[model samples]
Target chain A: MEHRPMIALVGNPNAGKSALFNALTGAHQKVGNYPGVTVERKLGRLALPDGRAADLIDLPGTYSLDAKSPDEQVTRNVVFGHQEGERRPDLIVIVVDAANLDNHLRFTLELIALGSPCIVALNMVDLATRDGLELDADQLSQDLGAPVIPTVAVRRRGLDDLKAAMVQGIPQHAAPLPVHSEHAAPDADELRRKAREIARRAIVAETPTRRITSQIDRVVLNPVAGPLILLALLFVIFQAVFAWSEAPIAMIEETFAALQTGVEAVLPEGFLRDLIVQGVINGVGSVVVFLPQILILFFFILMLEATGYMTRAAFLMDGLMARVGLSGRAFIPLLSSFACAIPGIMATRTISDPKDRLTTILIAPLMTCSARLPVYTLIIAAFIPSTSVWGGIGLQGLVLFALYVAGIFGAVVVAMLLRIGVIKGPGGSFLMELPKYQMPLLRDVIIGLWQRAWIFLRRAGTIIFVTTIILWLLLSFPKPPAGSDQSLVEYSAAGRIASVLEPVLRPIGFNHEIALALIPAMAAREVAVSALATANAIEESEDEDETARTLGERLQGRWSLPTALAFLAWFVFAPQCLSTIAVARRETNGWRWPLFMTAYLFALAWLGAGATYWTAVAFGL
Target chain B: MRLTSLEPNHPAYVESIDWNAMSEMDSRRLRELGLHEGASIELLHRAGFTGRGAYACRIGRMIVAMRAAHAGAISVRTGAE
Candidate 1:
């Protein structure tokens, strides 16, 4: 039996490590949970020299082996083969940032200390050269006693040399350099002395280029201008999301509408028609329609992240974050939560302190994910007039912006409360490295957007598919009263259940239509749109305008303004999506936080919605 | 002087670090930044309010931050004067 070697891909965060891994392994990858943790372990097989294959593991990105966060801990553990059930890597391929090698080397040196066979793939070499960097790869390799190959992972450079080096194997147990230890960590003074000495001897830079990054950072990171610029950037992103996505969203809506009509027409007008048109078509179509918006949001985020502006943004936000008892590192995950809470919660694994991680998880759902977009768009479209403000700024878009702002405020307040009340611990300080800015790689950005779209489609096909079918069954069963001409749904089990639940929700301004929407929204919040579409008996039409007209007409007389606002308020705090809850459970490793999250969120939602309803009614809106 | 009091553009040589007194996470973080004892660093930017104690400093080319409490633990001598 031929024994193939194992090669581990390691790098600092945002060093194009994943893109490189994807380039190397391409469709040969499997994602699994690491033993005893929810952090994803990505493994794939790649062909080595001599026509044999080697296993490749993409380790989580960390700055150094001095692990702070659980994800970093796992990376450290797995690299040193300290993790149970994980084999020691035969060769370690360190992915270093070509432009920012000074900091990247910290981790590289730590990896070297592990005494593993190693090679350095100087990634992002293109960016470094663009910035007028001259690296002596051979000299650096000789200095560190390792083979260093310059690579542009995004452009697929240096793969052959990297692979050849992997197959050739590195010198085993080379003299240990003075680097940070992986385990039995030395005292802080000793580590610093070693780091300084290593830097003094191994690293050298020619005349420092007065880079444009510092000039831009001067204004963007200015105390007064920084926050304003951040606000403006956020405003522009949301405005662009709403403005640019409208055309594509309309197109998707029209397509789905035509498909729904065709499905309804071909299938007999009975159970089969209902299931196909209402459950499968309407349910999946409603959620999938927002794909353009989700993709657009991710596109901008990936662009910002790739260009290295996000780290500076985090640096700018450090003070505010610390005030709320979170490190600056928490900003990335929280910002990601605005796109979707599940991944946002997962990203919190990067936070080192257990208290910070748990607090981040507890409040992540309040970040107004894209799932809430459908509900916000629906309510705002129905209630807020589509008038523009300040020369073509959509009033509806402003309201949508306000809703997002409210969610962020709520999350921060909750985080503050949790820090003081529940997870009473000293907030961890922020210490992050801001990488040099570069134009984002087009390939990586597109691939990132594609991955997000794939995740959304997958969710629609699986969780939303099954839940909608079950909901359709419950809502369509048991024929109406014998003497009545009402549709079966009017007297069905779902209708009865909604009516019974209506009294409890009445104080929150929810009628049977809104109450019925909640049942399906539990699976995924975006499913509420389809639930409402089905409940209102809006027939499938080929034209998007007609579908919008039908929905608007159905809701016009039935829902009061207060009720619409109240429903938005409800979702502002609603613990409706079980996927987020499941992620919270997995991340926390206990039922306690998720349960607490659900209970408190539900209570807050009820109170908030009820307060909005009564307050609006008192004003006689 | 404590590391926290260093003014912007002031260079400092780290004299000592009380690693045992610090949180394990903080110690690990400090090590990652190359800020262990004997490293010379410079305070680059102090953007946040003093009460909150958020500041950015550079050790070589890598910039990092810590709260006032943690920064107070590291002894340094300013080279500015």
Candidate 2:
């Protein structure tokens, strides 16, 4: 039996490791969860020139082997064969940024210290050359005592050479280098000195690129103009989300309406018919309608991240964060929250300081995640007038922007309070390496957006789908009294529960309809739209106007402008999603912080809603 | 002298690093600074808030951070001559 070697691909964050892996493995890749952790492990087999297959594992990106974060720790463990049941990699392929070899070499040296057979994949050579970088591949290879192959992972450049190098089995030579105390167990000074000496012999730069990046950075990264640019970018993105997604959203809505009508026409008027048409179709439709908006949000985020603007944005925001006693490193995790709070909360592990991590966890949920897009869209579409100002800033976009701003403000306030009250510690320093700007790989951007969309749909199909069905059953069963004109729902268990809860919610502007919606919204905020559709008997209607007219008429004389505003206000601060709470619990390592977060958000929502309602009544709007 | 006061382009030599005085993580970070006893470093650039400054310098093959306080500690021989 021929024994195949195991190969590991490693690089810095967003260094095209995945793209290279995909290029090499193509359709042979399988993605699975890493044992007990949620971190995804991508493994595949690549054919060697000799016709033998080698196993390839694409490890998570890490800055160095110091293992500051969980992702980094996992990478460290896997590469060193510390992970249980995992064989040590026969060869380590160090993916270096050809454009930014200075930063990339830090990891290279660290990996060299591990004494693994290694090859350097100089990725993004195209970008490096475009930026006027020159590299003598042979000289670099000779210097480092390893084969150096130039590769453009996005363009699939030098992949064959890389494969050939791997197949040839590059010799492992331990170069004399300085080992920092943090890296190994002993001889820190000696090791670091040796590492420097090796670097002096191996690495050579034609011209320093930092000066150019810094010169460009002065203008774009200026504190005053930088924030303005950031705000302008965000405003444009929000506007685009509403403008670009409108047609697709309308198409989805119409498709679902047509499907609902078809189902109602074919099935008999009974509980099963209603369950299929009104419950399942409507429930799933409500979630699906928000997909375009979610995709749009992700598209812009990926673009911004790809363009290398995110690091500058984080750098600009560092001063403000320091004022509130939070480190700038919290920016990435908090920004991730805009897509979903679960991963956002989980990403807080990057912060080495425990107190800073907790502070970041507390504020992450306030970053208007994609899940809240449906609630915001539903409320804004129903209440806010559709108009444009200053060329094409849509009114709906304006409202969405305001809601995002409100969430950000709420998060900052919460962070400030937490710093002063609970986890008080001196603010630590911020250190980050800003990479050179490069055009994002379309393949990676598309894959990222696809993964986000799939995750959203999966949640809807599983948790939201099951919860909606249960809710429909609860609101449909326990038939109404005979000879009574009341709908069957008025006598159902859900109706009784809402009626009992109505008194407590009435002062805050919640009617039975909204109250009923809230119960299912707890499962997922977007489900409230489906619940409202079911309760109003609007899902079975053939005409859009009939459904809209009935819902509008039912809510017409009952809800004042203040009541609608109050409802919007409530959702802005409402802790309605259970997944967020569960994630918060896991991130914080106890129920204490999640409980406090839920309580504060709930109280804030109620107070804000109550105040809006009363104030609207006073103004007679 | 604090690192915050180091003039851009000036060369500095680290005399010593008191790893025990810093937090474990901060100490680890200091070790990565390439300042382990007699390494020569230069301040390449500084842009951001003056109070909590963010600087960039080359250490081995990496451009790593040198906090204002840490930067100040390295005794420098000005290259202006």
Candidate 3:
């Protein structure tokens, strides 16, 4: 294989490096983890003007060569060629924000001092001009002794110039530059001073126009109104996840039913047909139907992130987060956890404090990830009537909101305990930059939604598909003896396992069916709903009427109101997803914290379910 | 006066910093943002009436949000001085 030249894009956080990468790569991007670390390594193929392609690695954003967080450390290691399992880049493209030169240029100066073959991408020049500042790119290029290309990443402006500069900076078959031994790393103070000087010289004209970001922040970050607006936005988001996804969820459900019916009509009555309809179609479909909700939630998150309102949210949340023994910096990660805990825990790299990061990781799963939506919505639809609670609040949406509140309440209590106990220390200081607000680009949001949707659909095809088959096999084996009134499920391998699990979960209102589902659910929380659908579909295979009913309707017939409520309570703290646990381990760099997280969550799940079950039962619900 | 005590829109220059009051990491972060002796700084906005929580300030041209504790460690002199 021919060795492709490697070029790395580096910059400070929120310098529009990702947007530039998206424009350069144009969907030829691969996101994975570096060896033994949870930090994401994003690689793309950038086609140079000379017709040869170069491998572009987007390094984590940093402030200076001096490492602060894990992200910054990775950037430093990659630049110095010390990162394990990563090749040294043949050239470095240092991206700087044009409007914020004094801060961004410090990192640019540091990277330039490394003596690496480099080019400067003065990105977001349009925003700079909009803010009433004019810059001479030639002056900056001369002072830095590098090629400077002004570009606006979102609009794809000046990309051709940037590509030409890259082609000129790196020769064909160029070798990675050896780290400079002569140039000792200057302290940050010195770099800042030099950066300020170069930035002043580059400015041809400046006008003092009020920044749009500050003006928006005046209202968005208002101490009183800010928090209320955040709450309202959150309430609307949760409600929208339920309201907006209903039609799509129905379409998916009907499509799967049709698919199952089609398979039944074409195939002869046998085991293979049963597996196809029950295991793959019904099982995976139960999980896949929740995709609309996940995408809606992710759309809002990606928009908030793209528009740079996420940090301002952190600022508003700082006070409330402080009361829970966390800083505002943890708020972003915790909020991301609502979409999924995997990315949420990974986002903890921005937190500089070790205890803070660990505590945030430990409580991340309590944020009611989108995975839990399947289980929550399934149970909610089965038991809760969709009627007007008050003026316009549906009982179903209110229950969904209550379940989310339950997760957050549990997290707050657990965080307080963890802080006062094992992770005892003074709270870490919160410090962060609130990036300028901009309209979220449509292309970027669509790309992000595509990635999330693909991950979900792929999981349905692979993990959930295989697990359902294995579960189907476990439920189908050792054919029941002739005329044995016992259902096939009760006589199979899964039944024996559930019988053993039943006693343990009995006090928490879990029945034999729920116990069977719990066994497969450990792979992924959404599998609980799929597992039940699979098991029920298998058991009712002979009865056309029972099989025709939806999983929610079937669940309503089998489970009491309290049992359904207990199941909801159980999921609020259940660390049932294997991916979340795996990511937690990788992030914490050991099994210790992950194991602690699992044990505590299981205990809480049991207690919470027991509490909810008994309370509902006593009330005659 | 401490940077936290400075009112919004009042531009000041750092006179001295009680680096001892901060963790090694915190001080390094502040320095990386160009908060040092004689560095131009301004109090942009404070979070609430208590004058606590996050204190948004401008160091050079960068807007930074820091806890009041970190802001309290930096003493500054206004242009009036």
Candidate 4:
């Protein structure tokens, strides 16, 4: 049996390398991390044309072998076989954009110089031809001394040719690209000139380019119109995410309620039954019910990125972000925080500046992720009336908008403080390539959404399920010694802890129930409502009519205006879920930043809640 | 003239890279993006409300943004509007 060889894909940024990897590996891809770093490692099993299988690795994009960013460093190390635990590739597939041939050829040439068995995948050839760009692949292959195959990665064109080329028996000592390494390492200028010289030999422009991308950019990148268009687009996405998910969210809640009822009816009312019904179903359900909203948010985000509009948004935000000691690249990661801080913190890997990236990570949890949505919605619906305030705007909706604003404002303030106080340094400059816009491919969008949904579901099933059970135990244990005349929950361990913490929590208008609920809430923000639901006996119901009461209504029966407002304020600066903190710890490579983040956020939360409580009470609300 | 001093809609040719004012990494990145000496550059827009930073420019065929501090490294000669 011949050993299955390892093949690698390398390319310049935005060269459609990832698209090519997805096309080549389809359905067999798995994502992991590089040893000792958080950079994603995407690998898949590749079935070669010659009936041989290969391990495919997708290296992060870079312009040259000279390592500038951390991502590029990893790619360099892995390619040179200097990275520990990563075997050098048996073959390399260099995916180059035919349209951006000149910019990509420099890196392509460097890879060829490494004396590895390499093939150049000239990706996006269809777009190049349509745009009247002419490139002779044979001429390029002749010039570079490597097989150059034209491919439209999105359409999966030329995979068979690429596969055949990859598995072709080529010695490691084959012809290398011209390199004069003894001449003090050719600078960027010398290397670029060499690349252009190679490009001039094989490339031709068929016409005076009338670029539709330029025409679109003229509007989208305009100083005046650009910001306006971006704002309007963002506004629509925000409104749609909230409005479109309402019915689906309600359906999820109703289904969970039914499940709880069905499960409780069969069991004979014991600890196990209570744990399964109230703890698992109702508790995990509360967290899972917010999935639709998260999905909607992610769907829009994936679409914006696919269409290449996200870069323009970042370009528009660069100045504002720079003023706060962040680069424009931080915008995407910060935006991801609006969905969940875990992924957002992970996304911070894209920011190259260590100080800027750390600051972004620390402030990410303040973005009011979807987990916080359930808490805000419950409080707002209970306290604020749904009656139209402005011409026809619902007051409850207005409160939700205000909460979102509070979270954004909180993030900015914290970032600014950190910028001046702790991580004081000049802001990193933003240099981004705004890729030409294209219609987003539906298949990719669907796949992206499915992955996010699976991740959210897995979290709800595992972490939320286990935490809810522990909470259930806390509220269920220390049995009441046969009719001593107190509720079973109050006699349990959690109630005792709540009673002890009541004095501290009471200043912010939280009662024993809210205080107790805060324990499980550490696992996820959405669990607080469920903890209260079971703690207050609201979960004790047999009929749909009884169980169908919105968590908001049940909450209103107990909380005062001041109390609810304080809770809202607390969420605005919430320290983040445990998972998020754990991610921060991992990302920062130590406990220092994560511990600092928790301390600062808890302080902010306490102060915000305290102020709101006192102010609302002073107004006699 | 300092590249930062170039006005919008005006074209200039980079004459020399006085990279002494910036870090080696920034200078190398600029070079990689084709901002070397003798490369043509056009100021497209100065970003933000007060136009403080992240200036938009056309270098060769690509549109890129950079801070004024980094822009200070490239000395340019006015070409045309």
Identify the runs in model 1 with alpha carbons over 4 angstroms from their true place. Answer: A1-4, A12-16, A22-32, A63-68, A80-88, A97-110, A113-115, A122-143, A152-157, A170-199, A204-212, A383-401, A484-487, B18-21, B48-53
| Shift of residue A85 alpha carbon in model 4, Å | 4.3
Q: Against the correct fold, how does model 1 do in TM-score? A: 0.88
Candidate 3 global TM-score: 0.92
Restricting to chain A, the TM-score for each candidate equals 0.87, 0.86, 0.91, 0.93
lDDT of 2 by residue, B1-81 (tens): 444566655666555555564567776665654345555556655535454545655443334554554555445444332
lDDT of 2 by residue, A200-280 (tens): 554455555455555666676664666678779877876787799888988988998889889878998998888887678
Candidate 1 lDDT over A1-621, as tens digits, reads 855677789988767788789888876777668877877788889997768888899998887666656677788877767777777677888888777665567667666766677898888887677666777787778766788888887788998888888877733443233233544554444444543454445445544666676667777667777778887988898778778988998888878878887887787888788788777887777778778877887888888888878877777777788788887778878877877887788778767777888888888899998888777777787788889999999999798778877788888889899999989977766667666676666876776677678777887798778877888888888777688876666677787888888999987789988888887788889777766776887765666456656676678679998998888888998955877887788888888999999998998899889998999999999
- lDDT string for model 4 (A292-388, tens) is 8778888988898888888778888888887677888888888888878988898888787789899999999988788887677667767887799
Q: How well docked is model 2, in DockQ terms?
A: 0.28
lDDT of 1: 0.76
Ranking by lDDT: 3, 4, 1, 2
**Per-model TM-score versus the true fold:** 0.88, 0.85, 0.92, 0.92
| Candidate maximizing DockQ | 3
DockQ, candidate 4, comes to 0.51
Give the least accurate 10-residue stretch of model 3 chain A, judged by summed lDDT. A540-549
Candidate 4 chain A TM is 0.93
Clashing pairs in 4: none
**lDDT of all the models against the reference?**
0.76, 0.72, 0.84, 0.80
Model 2 TM-score relative to the real fold: 0.85
TM-score of chain A of 3: 0.91
